[model samples]
Target: MNGRNPILAEAPTEPMTGISLLGTTALLFEAPGETSLAVQRRIWSLAREAETWPEVREAVPGVNNLLVTWREPPRRLAAIVERLAAAWETASPLALEGRTVELPVVYGGEGGLHMADVVAHTGLSPEAIAEIHAAPVYPVYALGSHPGYCYLGGMDPRIATPRRKVPVLRIPGGAVSIGGAQTGVSASPGPSGWNTIGSTDMIFFDAARTPPALLQPGDSIRFRIAGVVR
Candidate 1:
């Protein structure tokens, strides 16, 4: 949303050559360009492929990057890089038949502390904002801000607003918020720069669960307006 990282910003104009090493233990595969379904699908595909490698301990996807990490750094980093490049070359856009999770939200009340600000920025009524937001079946781009938190793509640009210049100390879990061109659901209580527009009851994470994360990469989300909070 803040634009691609400097390393990737200038490269989208050219062909996606391959993955590059972030350091000794991680590989960063740059996305073709801005966050999109095609790019995210490719990233998720590469992540799944990297998991097949014996050295990879985790493969985390970002908005426009794929980061693969190893428990123990490989001795021949070049070999790993080459292997990733090969995988990228043959990788196809992942066919993710992911389940759709519908989240019921109560918009514009005490929970949505920044609702007024959002209304002011977008010049839309609270109801209009909620309608625009809930209309799309957003793709889960990546999970990163906090455990089980989702970075969702496909927000209506009409409702898009920049993050708060000064971040709030803490927002409750299940907070539906927006930052820049992206919208997301918070999974835990934490500091955030995004503006909260609503709150949902959907549980995002539970340590007792086997996978812990409720939403996986490639999944889709639909928000429903339960009612207004106030």
Candidate 2:
């Protein structure tokens, strides 16, 4: 776990940096090994540092990855890549303590259109699945996919389901779904490849408000079992 964190203090040596370019405009850096909260903390640390640089327009954090967008596409591409890599080597964990949100979710019916799919995959009853799913206080890892959507961590791997081979054309807001080892709630109606097992009515995005996205990195979500549809 320490090897995965960018913190040179805890980790005697950093994992080999996964560096590449996103077209000509931005650079991508992926922390090696499986996704973990420790790695994401380092990402937060790196994002904080990189965002202040004169060359960076924004430093976006994803699951074990970071995207460094430039203020302008620099001519010194090699030099920029080097600098970014150097920054990652020195980054430390930025563990954030954020607010917790409890969402009342309805599992397995219209809201959870894909509950049967999950049941079949896990060989677990809907009741058991719902119990397992709501067991943890999941941390909001990153905000991506769509406006206000939160990528959550800490799902019980027993119920881990893969993303649908054929993506749903549209899923309503607050659609709770599991994709691979991760789980998240759809912020708005849109196409998704994840399996929707439940839903909550909470408004994840509000354009009319400040800091539009409902959840920030490090915040936690507790999924309350509002009801279970047969």
Q: What's the CA error at residue 79 for candidate 2, in Å?
A: 2.3
- Which candidate has the highest lDDT of all? 2
Residue-by-residue lDDT tens digits, candidate 2, 77-99: 66666677788889899989999
Candidate 1 residue pairs that clash: none
TM-score for all predictions? Answer: 0.87, 0.90
Model 1 stretches with alpha carbons more than 4 Å out: 1-23
Q: How far out, in Å, is residue 155 in model 1?
A: 0.7
Could you give the C-alpha RMSD of every candidate to the true structure, in order shown? 7.0, 7.9
